[model samples]
Target: MDLFDRLQEQIGTVRLPLFAVTVTAAAQVNTPLIAILHWHGFRRATPLVLPGVEIPSRAVPGSAIQLDAPWHSFETVDAMLLDAAWQSGAWDVERVEQRGCNVIGASAAETLACRQAFGDYGEDMVRDPQLLGDETDRDGLMQLAARRGYVRWLFRPVKGGLWRTLDEPDDTLEVDGGRQPPCPVSPVPRRPGGSGRTVYRLGKVHRILLPR
Candidate 1:
């Protein structure tokens, strides 16, 4: 049987209510937690953003965010989370840790399922280290996912102060909707071989246009 089918069979008929799945890090590091949750069809109804944590970092500094989901059962939720993490090349058995808890209160079954799933998946991930891609690429993909709304933008404070959103204005654009173009042009000086036209080179192609 497939992994999902096997997990379902092993979990039996146990069901749990809504719960929160949280992942903590020692420093501000990018992971695919949200993307994985979304891939598993889980919605992050409420996200708790904790800023200015005690994590130390020289380049980038930020706080950890706890994402909460109201899943029907821990077995299915854990299975999906594990599968998504594996597929997205984000599961790190060593550096990253995850936990789940009942949203309203605590439940034995839910907690057990969480621990069991973590142990099982964590081992599998370690056995197959190829599941993870390059750290740089993974971080880039996470940023792209956040920009596309596939995941919430959790970290704002970084090495550069705050991460800018896609909708934020760029420095090149002027308030009046007009600014100096990126290309540089020299006025056509009156000379023997000059056609009195401004010349600009664009990536290997030379073009002459009327000066506005």
Candidate 2:
């Protein structure tokens, strides 16, 4: 069976907590902003303790941190983000969304369930030996116990840059006003039984606070 099918099976039988936090910005300033937020305790305030796991001092400056906190709930993360934004006066943040389902199981089973649920996001984090810190790799089993939480941020400088019609090119020019090469856009199959219109999933956009 494929990963998603396995996930559906595990999710159906297990009783553990699985949550994800996604943050989107109007422009591509999410990386630095998130770093600043983490510096100010948005990342450290979580009480979810992983015995041997060492949380990064700061999230990777450019990349987002994917699901790595199984002990935390969606609501808990949502509140933390809001509080951080408020305290840091990061009015540029547009929206924050957290979602998770309950799937109970033993520690091992819980880890497997989260690993499957988070998919590639979890895999990338788990496979990184440096990210795993002092944890021993028992045939890659250590990853099973790691948290499957992640933070994703998106930003678009132009308000309607992403709203172009299906046939339009998907590339954006360089900030220096140079004629940048166009990037390829992948085509997605239309959903069955619905209108034949193409759909775009922009995810969610939220405002985040940055340190001055």
Tens digit of per-residue lDDT, candidate 2, span 107-198: 55444433332222354555432121122222232232232222322222111121211222222322321121221222243233211223
- For each candidate, what is the lDDT? 0.26, 0.27
TM-score of each: 0.18, 0.20
Error of 1 at 49 (Å): 30
How many clashes would you count in candidate 1? 0
Best by lDDT: 2
lDDT of 1 by residue, 106-207 (tens): 466544434332221335445433221222233333333322212111111111111112223333323321223222222222222211222122112135
Off by over 4 Å in 1: 1-59, 90-212
User: Which regions of candidate 2 fall more than 4 Å away from where they truly are?
Assistant: 1-70, 95-212
